[model samples]
Target: MMKIRKLLDIRERSIRYGSVFRVLGKWPYEPLVDFLLVYSPGCDRKSNLVVSTGHKAGLIMERLPLESSLEHGANGISTKWAISNWDEWIYPDCPIEDVFVID
Candidate 1:
């Protein structure tokens, strides 16, 4: 089990589904603690079901049930996921703040 880090910031957009977050600490494979936590909002309300990283246009990686736990805060929920393969989990773009709203 990897040690979960505190969430430094969150990047949200008007899409109303997925959100990206930056953590304080780093993981095994990932040099940076940035992650894309995706979930269903309406009925499922499955938060942090899909954890991913890397550029949205380039190769993206993902993990299930984000293993690492996060520090509780008002900005957003704290959660973490283990490092997995560079699977096909494309998101909008990095520095999500530039493209998405910081919520």
Candidate 2:
């Protein structure tokens, strides 16, 4: 059987300006794909129910494994790669919206 690996855990970095901490970096992009799929009709309709359901269910069921992997120093999944590699999983003919923005 193939071994499944978990994506990276969210990390935080403090933003400092000279003498004061001003901002913090957040993992805002990690769930962008899931959000897009859930909200966008074109993407949602084209998505495979079984695959999406299984993916979500697996995430929950494998939480312990995922956390363990992160504790053991696994790298997080790349948002850039996920965005750029849509064609690998999504059908070429599927109608993908040109714009997706989260407010």
Candidate 3:
């Protein structure tokens, strides 16, 4: 969760569905943590679903439902799909992945 708070210090407003970010540099405790921080600024300005790192990944915080889905695969395999297809979503060297929105 702190990783995301750090990212929020560099808050990205333009984000999209299925976007991927290649973590750059050496974040503190990056090797110790097994989760990636996924951020979505939302397309309509209101998020329909919030995505965590991946199945059994990311610091879910106090959110039990979100954590359960990732840990238990209760999200109808979407979590598994994300894990299995993680590499496919990667865009070389991109830190924040998404389409820029002009408001």
* TM-score, every prediction: 0.29, 0.22, 0.20
lDDT of each: 0.32, 0.22, 0.28
lDDT of 1 by residue, 1-103 (tens): 3222222222221212344444332334254444555543453333442334433222234433322233342222332122211122222233333222112
Q: lDDT, candidate 3, residue 27?
A: 36
Residue-level error in angstroms, candidate 2, position 92: 4.1
Ranked by TM-score from best down, the candidates are 1, 2, 3
Identify the candidate with maximal TM-score.
Answer: 1
Could you tell me which 10 consecutive residues in candidate 2 have the lowest summed lDDT?
A: 14-23
Which residue pairs overlap in candidate 1's backbone?
A: 66-80, 66-81, 67-81
Cand. 3 Cα-lDDT = 0.28
Candidates 1 and 3 compared: the better one by TM-score is: 1
Clashes of 2: 1
Q: How much is 102 displaced in model 3, in angstroms?
A: 21
For residue 97, model 2's alpha carbon misses the true position, in angstroms, by 3.5
lDDT score, residue 46, model 3? 19
lDDT of 2: 0.22
